[model samples]
Target: MVGVEVKGTTRLLGLIGDPIAQAKTPSVINPIFASRGADIACVPLQVPAADLQKIWAGLKATSNLIGFGITLPHKQMAIDLCDSLDPVAARVGAVNLVRRERDGSFRGYQFDGRGFVRGLQAKRITIKNRDVLMIGAGGAAVAMAFALIEAGAKSITVSNRTLEKAEALASVINGDFGRLVAKAGSPRPQTGQLIINATSLGLNETDALPLDPGLLHPGMTLAEVIAQPEITPLLSQAQARGIEIHSGIHMIKGQVDLIADHICELWS
Candidate 1:
């Protein structure tokens, strides 16, 4: 038997967000694509919320552009740009993955929620019947909460700097998931089995945690979805506290595989 040679021009995939310079997707996914013999190049696109639609619309006609992984403000905005939404994406109300079809129509999907669930499982973190205390109410926060519930979390308590935002996220989850253990108050949800820092609070060198470190116990597992600085401030605290820490790198890895598969399925 002889090996068949495979080769192609580099196809471009990108991540679009306001503070895109902080994104690690290009570094993470590019190597994976290269290892798989995929001639693809990934870039971080610093696209403001106001220009998301314009930038995406322009990509519709670009033949060399393969796909995009959305972030921040655009994750929710992408729902409006897609020709269709996958069921998970619809329920989460966020679209992190966009697949450009042969006809140039992009259908939106969300892999973050699903990826988080799967990544946790890969790490032997059981979601079923676990009490979850989720912090932050932004796109990533919302997705993590929903993913935990869908994976059969026993209870969930959400907290954010803005109580109203946390409550609003709870409303959407309650409407969709039918009775999650959501609340807003002081002391930060009493620290459940899992403590998730979904906020960007730990992204900066000087950012303090939304909750006091005394609230986090060694028995609980601390997970943060912030990719930059790899070892985030929250994870640093968790380490000193003797709590188990899962880095944002795992979530990024999960998305890389799914994103690659989505592009190959849709474009190849």
Candidate 2:
């Protein structure tokens, strides 16, 4: 395992979010940089939602800063700050990774959806032709829904606490895909081969489980996007029922290399 050796000339990369203590990007990304002998260090910064613009301006002024990762409340907000967005980010309506151009302008790209798909593939779980039931209609959920459609999921049923938000996301997805790929549904886990908890419900120890654990069956696959507790309550229940589970750590690991390559390209 290689280690990060910082110096005056080491390049800077950051993971920004409000309440960023749960971020695990550095632990997953820094070692990749070290292994490749790249003189870059990834750090976490807690930037409040109110101060994002001010902080973004300061980040642009730092010549050594190559790029940064966005999380939580800022992913959608960061999209407006970028000069351009990759197709994935544009479709997802969020930006999880931003690359600084030679002229110091920023370009945003989204990896959440791709990361989740890749994580599923790593576990030999196929999304193609499968019915997916996604909980939460937030940025992460939207990204995953788009990715699932792109990956050839037969259909996606999006459920959220707010039915309007879920309906809105489904409309956007169906419009973009030119088909009935997504539809708004109730929070109850629908009958689907794949079930995803894209909500933050599992982040806190006392939070309610995203869905009724009893709904998880032996043949179903469950996945989550909360990385802090690798095995979230929803996941634990699914595991106990002999259901296949994919953790948020898998999503992070799956994207680490892709993100490293993108940032290294900008630096070079």
Cα deviation of 120, candidate 1, in Å: 1.4
lDDT of 1 by residue, 1-268 (tens): 0122223666778788887767888887776676777767777788988887788878877778878888876887788888988887887888887877777778788888877887788899878988888887777777878878889888777777788987888788887866646655443534447878777777778887767777777678888787887788778877898888888778887678888877776554
User: After aligning candidate 1 to the native by TM-score, how far in Å is the CA of 241 from where it should be?
Assistant: 1.3
15, model 1: CA deviation in Å?
A: 0.8
- 99-200, model 2: which lDDT tens digit per residue? 898888899999998898898888889799999999988888888888888888999988888889999999999899888888898656655579989888
Each prediction's number of clashing residue pairs: 0, 0
Cα RMSD to native, each candidate? 3.9, 1.6
Q: Which residue runs of candidate 2 sit more than 4 Å off their true CA positions?
A: none
